[model samples]
Target chain A: MNEVLLPGVGLRYEFDTAEGNRIGIVARRDGRFEVVDYDRRDPDRSRLLLRLTEEEADAVAEILGAPRIAERFADLTREVPGLSAGQVEVAADSRYVDRPLGETRARTRTGASIVAIVRGEAVIASPSPVEVLRAKDVLVVIGTPDGIAGVDRIIHAP
Target chain B: MHTSVALLLELGLILTALSALGALARRFALTPVPLYLLAGLALGEGGIAPVPAADEFVEIGAAIGVVLLLLTLGLEFSLGEFAASARRHVRSAVVDLVLNATPGAVVGWLVGLSPLGVLALAGATWVSSSGIIARLLTDLGRLGNRETPAVLSVLVLEDFAMAAYLPLLTVLAAGGSWWQAGLGVLLAVGAVAVAFVASRRWGHQIGRLLSHPEPEQLMLRVLGTTLVVAGLAELVGASAAVGAFLVGLTLTGVVADRARAVLAPLRDLFAATFFLAIGFAVDVRALLPLLPAAIALAAVTAGTKVLTGAYAASLDGVGRWGRLRAGTALIPRGEFSIVILGLAAVADPTLGALVTAYVLVLAITGPVLARLVRAPLPARSGPNVRVDRR
Candidate 1:
């Protein structure tokens, strides 16, 4: 089912759950969107996903070089261009900057790793896979959304 | 109308109120259980139509209700969650039991009941309504927070304790001897073990059935599952509510959640009836003379749980006041307490009126006590507000 994007007139994009659910906050050019998308399983944890309608120069800088590459395939199974739309969305999961490299690595595929760690005011180019995660390491990685979700899981597990 | 139709009407009155109250209470920012008991009070001798005129039949039915309630509760816990925090949960459980039981036992005696009965009362009230609180918290958007996990961990332990406590109470209520008590404890420990093992073995199959239901047969399948499982729980000397809880517990994974969503109509239907029956079935005037006793008992019960819960919260290392709020949140004596009193009256004839009064007063005023003592849980934490989303 879909909701009308406008109050009157009609611009509506019916949701497609088969594409996998997009939930949680959608921080965007407009006010953030908190949509309760369907999960085939538990519906209690309504996910919120955002879209950036505005791309001014500073906003473009925050867009991180390229759009995400994660959303293309229904599922991420093998090595593919990390620049795929789906992958780009995966990287863009967080608008926030501070994160742990280890945690980011953990969220992605166990096979996949973050080759570079970037965060506020500083950057770690080609950080080793074994590097212990510090609190403020902004992560750039190659892996599936599940893997990223896993990494998010580990960081918050304790 | 035919007798069957009349019975249906009676049943509908009870259950509809149960669902509607839950929905309404949540809508109004009040808890559902008290609304249930108030429904009970209103439906009792004084209110409108009295269904729970005596606790005997309803007592047995309530046993079944508890089983169903637990079924829902068990669904909420996960092995992954358990595995992650086992050690901390153990520490938390130990701290909570001690803190909660001391006052529970003492106050039970001070109120002129057996220490065992008081201890039972304490145990029943010790655990807060996680489902109630969790739903409220989720609605309020405070469900996922840094501190919330810590709080949830505590609740899981308390829930586990409550699960175990009901079985032990059942055995004792059924006249198990002291020696049997030891054996009963051992058996309950075994039950948990059995629940885990069974879940491991049949969990997948249960989940699968939940997912692939025939459209015409879906209703039958869901109803059968609650009844058969709850019946089995009683056969094994556990409450049916706890049994339903176990069923929900075992059927984890994506499918369980799917089943839960589909089974919503049934759960809410039965659960609402269950609450409404609790309200309408009671005899209010018979309980009126016991007002002095109930008030004293309520004061003592609330005082004990709050004080003890505060102590438990303190161990979490929050400040004096925050701990106090946590303690206060634990105060409301809801369904289980009412069920226990009803069960006790069945087990012992002389005590029915007094116990009913005890549950009545506690149920009505408990929420007021909760608000007075606890801080409002913070508003929902926006995911964007996170410092790190890794």
Candidate 2:
């Protein structure tokens, strides 16, 4: 990895993957991060991959670091009979989009508990009743298979 | 407790006008610095409207603005980065100083300015606006470019140079003799060295002393310490700005980061007021007469900045177009130039008008030129290739 100092801006770290692609990450002073790939044609210039805010960077770190989190839950579910952990994605067209998590009444209607909510790179563990559910959120539902199916039905219902 | 309604009304109106101007500048991808100066001109004597009531406040605010500016500048300093840049770009910095400062010095001599005025003008032209250029690079998505480190290193070295240069200028501006000015420079340089050593050795202890969990407490601690230090610096003729910068340099790690976050808004407000005060101090009539000279000086110095940038980029082995981009990127002269002028404005009355006009021209045109350089040459093909010039 090549670490470059940008002075008043921030530090930039660049490295080449085994695949021969050079990746650069510019960590700004204002808690913003920019990821870019070196253009093959112009080794000096880079193509911007994405810009991430501090929170988004944190969420990205979490996602990349905690890939085994769900698998751990899956292992726990294996010990019980007829119990499973399922992820229910909140589609854009879901009726409960932008509504509070309580509005889904997943626990009351389906006897399933939402263990967590994953929005983008962020995971909200043990989300409160007032936690708003946005489009494309994946709710980690823990319950029997039928109950998990029932919660999904309630979330997607018109 | 008597309050002046006129002061309140005038200040409110001025801030509103500044905000409107700032928005307009941002819309066009320009810095609001020149606009703020224009507003200051209008608000100054014999322009359009004069705010006598707010004059005292602006004056004091302007002083604080310089302190805050240097303080934050110091806060941004990292010993590691400075060492790296200095090692790589010492030649570039020397080239930058020579190529750029010469025009302003020559123009100053031609215009028959005092020896001190010549020195100040030279500095005003030499130091590119790091604030404006940094933002420009980010906005134009050139941070990831090959020549960027070269550009940034030059800026860092220039800012570090100011720590030494400012004290010398301050002593001279204060009507001190050459020996006194030389001593002041030595004193300031020694102080800077001491600051670096102290920051490295006792940084955490110093950080702990100033660090407070509450934002308000932290702000108070840092600002109070900086102001006191700045005042003492001014007393010794080292210049308050340098003192504030030293204070900034001493802080490191989390304390510096939090201090920066808390003080940013205050710095912005005061820094804008400082710019306004520079405009207010100058006579608009004087400014018009100096426009031609300012333009000519801008033209010469702008070319020099490009040459300096190209040379620096070349050191990094960047090809022709990339070098051009680097050179043009370093063109804009902003706050620091104004700060230099503000320091020496008293030496020559016309100095204010000339520097203001010069900064206004380059500050507006520099970014535009950099952007223009990018339009014709897309980064992929022509000049992005590394050329080993050994």
Candidate 3:
């Protein structure tokens, strides 16, 4: 990421993701952030524009970047001796992809509850059962090692 | 002694009533200014029961209110921001001055006011309520809109203009010989210019004096300094509010924000009293006579304010709806108008009633119009709209 100071305006941070998505975040002096997403096909044409408070921007960044949540939830890991918290990628082969959380029943069968689901740059924490999981959804689950493995099987089932 | 006790009881009851009204206004999402004014009117000479004892105290409180209002306004812009915004948006500021101020002056003239009264009316009409405008923008989620910067720049310019206009009006309204008034004006101009230079040179050092972390200490220091300076300005025949404003400009950096946090509630309390005192001075009977003229003047000035915003936004290449939104958002006039009229309250008989009626009309309409003129489509918009959606 490259950050440029636009004098008299604000600070603009621009970067390209490994997936070839272009993003630019402008942090205004008034403590607001403007996030601009460009279509990979046409870098000049913006696909989405968003204004966010600092907190919202931080939340979104945590979802997109996996290491952020690990650092943020380090205390939780330390509080539980045997328990672990990790994110699982819902790839193309995942059977529960595009299905609602209630229908998957991963919590009921494996004793591993999905605490959050991160899709793209959006974070849905303490999600309701009706929330539909989609491809590229990253599920943040908490359980014992055995439970996590069981739920991982449930999601990855083809 | 009996009258003194009566005054104490009356003041206590009036304050309690005003607090209730303030709550009600908040519940209705309305600015409590008109309500406060109405309460003042109801308690004044022509109302059901007049406040004889507490009127003097209320008058002093109202003066403090004006100083605090101007001071907080000054705190919002540092000298650098003020100077930069003025330079960049000089065109809009000029347009605003010409368009918004003329209607009041013309109306003042039509009503056969003295030259000073006309000047007071112009000052009343010229500036928009920064407090109201800022609140409405936040409420309507338009702070990130394309036209917001245009709106903000005009507001800053008006404040900058006030640095000059306020002194001019104060001197003229002080009621002295022509030479004395002229000298006062020159002296005021010199004082403001000196303050500006001092702010540029030693604003940081001044800022350090106000940087106490303890809220109580901070409040005491800030308010004490403001009142002393304000009193000195009034002693010199310039408006105390102008001195308070210059003090605000001088305290830059973190201290300005901290002072704002500490001083806001006091400002609100005193400012509400200021509005109430204006209402208190007004004869209810006089209001009916001036109602028509006030409405007519409000209608004209509203159009002109909109034009000022639209023209400036258009120059900035904002879209049609954005321009309209800019114009309508500029409508609400609040504290500043009342502060100006508050100074003129004693000088002219009909000035209070006329200004009260005029400001009430626009202050109510301004926020409603701002909410109404929002553009539905955010196409080709400025950089920030996504966060507002959530």
Candidate 4:
């Protein structure tokens, strides 16, 4: 969250959930981040555009309860793989998870995978770890809503 | 009389008036070209300022605008990608064009017009405006179906004709020898053929070159190649954009699915400018006296085009709904008609005026007619193809 590409240019970091793939990302302005990678799989497929920002990403991540899914995109590859921005729901199945709050959601959560993170009209491309899970992220988790709620408390708890 | 401020003011006034009228037409679901044309007529002869010599500028300017649109459109004509399209659509496209254009031409001749004018009209209206009809069909989630092929083929044929016939008319009117016309047509075919041959012969080398290059450099080469090829076509009397289109068509087969994305932004910018230019500095007065004729002609253009579409589509198991949709799809006319008219106008001013009047109707009423024709959409090319996937 505290990274700067250049002077006075405090760039935020993020990844989007696009076509079910994790991608690296950097944001130059508020509310729009450049997709850097989709889970370290391929870089040539760059220029993945997304509409969510770090703050909005935080809100969405918290709401979805799969903050770690943002970082651990590799887990969702088979089910809800990452992609660039613009897909709403990937239609992957998921089960609920009940877990205690711990390190980053990536370090803690198990079993539950995020199928997608649908916000307003667009999907977050390929989200990544180290990217803050926002309350706005409507994480389309594989598990039930309660499982998502438990996972939410794990990463987002102060 | 030659007040400078008055001119700018008039321009703004016309755009605003036409825009407002267009909005109203949309609200009422009436065609807007008639409204735009009416606005031109009222302001031209009936109002404070007249749109003098609209006929002259719109003639060529409209053609260029359509060229821009066609240039954008050429990307869609990629044969390879559509190879994966449904068999139903392919059959439909063939049946649709032969059925529609052939009869449509005869009927146009039956109406009061010269042979060349009738030929141009038949050619212009034969295939539905693929751009318009395809878009509406896509919106309705019917672009990939049994009838989709017929609709798309007619649309594809008409679009290609727009670029080709436009220049053909120009060559004829310019008094170029039939030899030159024959030569120009030959060159056009050759250019398109060469692109395929070259791409087949060396497409991989180009793709490899693109794989590791800076995004900027890759884009530069693409643009450079497109321009160079298109320019060559213009040098030999073929449409330059048509050449670029062929290059695109050639590359589509070689490049696979990435070609469309590569050209998306470039096409979008050029397309926007092209459409906006259609609304550019057009005079209103010259059209004043021709208003009645223009109106009548617009009706003829739309009626004939719709009938052709309906007839062509009907032969392909395109049910009543498909036929109706085809009819409405053919409603919009823009660049191709303008091209034919502009070229013909050179041989005879009367033919030119008639074509111009007709295309104007197509451009304006195209959207409205689409809106009015509310039959259930035809099926898509594949069951997996999402509605509005385009």
lDDT of each prediction vs. the true structure? 0.53, 0.90, 0.77, 0.48
Question: Stretches of candidate 3 above 4 Å error?
Answer: A1-158, B1-8, B177-179, B376-390
* RMSD (Å) of each candidate, 1 decimal: 13.5, 10.2, 13.7, 15.4
Model 4 over residues B115-230: C-alpha lDDT tens digits? Answer: 66666665655544444454455345332223344555555554544445545644555567667777677676666567666666775455445432244564566566667776
Instruction: Count the clashes in each prediction.
Output: 44, 0, 3, 61
Ranked candidates (DockQ, high to low): 2, 3, 1, 4
On DockQ, the leading prediction is: 2
Query: Candidate 2: global Cα-lDDT?
Result: 0.90
Tell me the tens digit of each residue's lDDT in model 1 across B94-167. Answer: 76666655555565566566535775656644655565544433333432211234445667777666666766
Could you tell me every candidate's TM-score relative to the true structure?
0.62, 0.82, 0.72, 0.53
What TM-score number comes out for model 2?
Answer: 0.82
True contacts kept of each: 0.00, 0.53, 0.08, 0.00
Native contacts recovered by model 1: 0.00
Kindly report which residue stretches of model 4 are placed more than 4 angstroms away from their true locations once superposed. A1-158, B1-67, B81-119, B144-146, B160-167, B207-220, B253-307, B311-315, B342-352, B364-367, B370-390
Q: What is the TM-score of chain B alone in each candidate?
A: 0.77, 0.96, 0.92, 0.66
Model 2, A1-158: lDDT tens digits are: 89888878898989999999898999997788888788775677766767789889868865885445677779989999888998888875576766899988889888999999988558899999999998668888999999999998898875
Sort order, TM-score high to low = 2, 3, 1, 4
The prediction achieving the highest lDDT against the true structure is: 2
Query: Against the true two-chain complex, what DockQ does each candidate achieve?
Result: 0.04, 0.22, 0.05, 0.03
lDDT of 2 by residue, B25-108 (tens): 998889999999999998996679999999999999999999999999999999999999999999999999999999999999
Positional deviation of residue B234's Cα in model 3 after best superposition, in angstroms: 1.5
